[model samples]
Target: MSDKEIVEPLIPASGSQKIDSATKRGRIQMILLLLVCAAPVIASYFTFYVIKPAGGKANIGELVSPVQPFPSNVIEENLVGKWTLLVARPASECKVGDDACVTLLHVMRQLRTAMGKERTRVQLVWLVTDDSVIDPEIAKSYDKELAGFTFIRMPRDLAKKQRLMTWLNADNEQSAIHLLDPRGDRMMRFKTGEGHLDFKKMVKDLEKLLKWNPTGKVGD
Candidate 1:
């Protein structure tokens, strides 16, 4: 046998390995993007839930555990961009009077107004749960142009309507005023009192939220 040295050839990386590496990179980038988008929301929650100011009491509005994301089938574009205070009532019940339905509407309107200049950052949404004709006076009073209110009719489709009801009545308090963040998550619920509604506490909670989660634009 001749004294010849045998050398092994170096192997190149396999296609599968390259693909796995690329996929990992893509996933990492996506995760980072999500974190960036969620940072403000996370920070606000942390401030409200974890770092309580001295003598600061718990939130007046009950926090919806795990939070309910706004149903995409139900006026999603309107809800997603701004902080929303939502109330659900049938048009038949929301007449121009001092009824519970009208009271809730007033509460939502005042809550937004209390924000002052930051009022524009908030949106009042009245979800009419039925096809009953809205009172013309009520409509005139809450005109979108003047009062900055957006009225959305409940989805006609049975499935879509059910999903919305499930979210709105998560606590079985369908008449409560719900709070939705800019990202469209229903995080808080304010229930009615004995023939009254506490406007001050609600204003405090809303102010804290606006202070902590200030956004420059509608969708920001």
Candidate 2:
């Protein structure tokens, strides 16, 4: 019998193995992109929350825990482009019965003026929570006094109004002024009593926020 040399055949990887490797590479790339995009947001949170300046207090306005989303159904604009000062009060509060709104509006206007050249970058929004039409005289007063104010209507139902109110925290029934970052996250609020709105404190707080956050773009 003739002697035959023994030989072994080389085997190539299965198609499934090549596909799995490609999928893994794609997933890694996606994860890296997500991290890159999210780095700034994470850093901002760290700087604002975890890192603190020695001997200095945080912002004057009460910072809302776990920032709330802006109610888009009320304001169609993204509201993310400029620092927004939101005045949230029910229209019923504005009925001829309530006189506090006058002082509230005045305080809000002064707060904006205190911003100096930065005023244009700050958007003032008045969120009315009831379906009741604003009294004509009051509407005209707003037009004449509060220039460039954005008026919006909140949900009419009491329950729905409560849900929207959850966006900002307040201790009492009195009207409150809220601050929204350029990104439109409800961040802080300034509560006020009948006629005792503190314009100076609010001004100081806003100046500090502007100095820290700035406009242009996030992290710029």
Candidate 3:
């Protein structure tokens, strides 16, 4: 074999190696970028879930192992930049004197109020789960302008409503209050009942979240 032919075969092999190396480097850079964006959220969650504080008090709300994302088709705004506290109740169920429903609404309001100056970082979302018109009185009570609460009604399309219901009731606890992180992941849920809900612990859980994730936007 001539020297020219030997060198010609080696050139293609060298070029192929360079292309493979460049592709790998590109992949690595992309992965690192994603990790950098995810680190803050992962670290905060690790602290809350794995590394307990001195007293060893775990989160009162049940943490959703893998958080659920907001249903984009149903929610016009995916609530990307705010921590959302969401609850689902029919307008009829939330009538003025209904104690269970009333207490649930009251707790939702107080939870945001408890955030104090951090309250703006949090949003209260009420998902009205039925077609019945909300009482003017109840609607006025949680007026968006006055109370900073956003009330979204269930989609009239049965399939869309079912999808939303499935997301909201992932734990099969339909009445529980769900907490969605700034990136729009439903990360934790607080159970509410006649007397089972622990208001103080719920407040602490929320306070810790706002304290740890102050920016109200993931990877900030």
Candidate 4:
């Protein structure tokens, strides 16, 4: 053997470095993807949170504090398939002839119109707080308002949680009108108060959320 040709064998690569590099790349990619997916939702929230609409124009709707993230299982089991929720805070049943009943019905009509062709996806739910049984005739009449209004009788726990939500006008803006998305998520809140609510704006935003997160739940 020639002394000049003598050479030691080269050590093989450990592959550990390559694996770690690959892992780091995967994590970075995942983070980037998450940020990209969340951009629209984050932007919408910023529009509502950071931007203060100039003047006393009165945005109408109020912002809730400590933005909540609902669990998918719970929302799916109970809230999905439910679109519009009209929570009546009065301690008694809402009969058709009463002032409260009239106001609620009208509000629902406006909500339906605001949704336009997507009206079918909109649903109405009445949370009866009292022990009194809902008059069958009154419940039957609710069917006429739109194709998807439903009346659900829930206990007080439901009301208390909602009460804890952020206030839009007064501390007690009871009997809320919630616009639930197709995935049964509560994104838009409405009121029958004196000032006007921008239902069209809300509907437009919802349409965007639906498109952006087509397979995932809103606020996910």
Candidate 3 backbone collisions, by pair:
none
lDDT (C-alpha) at residue 52 in model 4: 35
Pairs that collide in candidate 1 are none
Q: Write model 2 residue lDDT over 85-165, tens digit each, in one string.
A: 778776667755466876777677778778777787777777876677887766766652455467778765666666667
TM-score of each: 0.81, 0.65, 0.86, 0.58
Residues 149-186 of candidate 1 have per-residue lDDT tens digits of 88889887889888888887776888788888878888
Worst 10 residues of 1 by lDDT: 211-220
Write candidate 4's Cα lDDT for 1-220 as tens digits: 7879969899876799889989999999999999986554465456554553433233444443433323343211355543445555432547656766656655566655565555555556665555777766666756635434555543346654354333322345555565444444445566666554455654554444333333332221
Superior by lDDT: candidate 1 or candidate 4:
1
Candidate 3 lDDT, tens digit per residue, 15-130?
Answer: 88999999999999999999987764675587687666525786678888777888877767567788889889988888888888877878888888898888888888888988
Error of 3 at 82 (Å): 0.4
| TM-score, prediction 2 | 0.65
For residue 171, model 1's alpha carbon misses the true position, in angstroms, by: 2.7
Model 2 misplaced regions, further than 4 Å:
1-59, 95-97, 144-146, 155-174, 194-196, 216-220
Which stretches of candidate 4 lie above 4 Å from their native place?
A: 1-16, 29-59, 63-78, 81-86, 90-93, 144-147, 155-174, 194-220
How many clashes would you count in candidate 3? 0
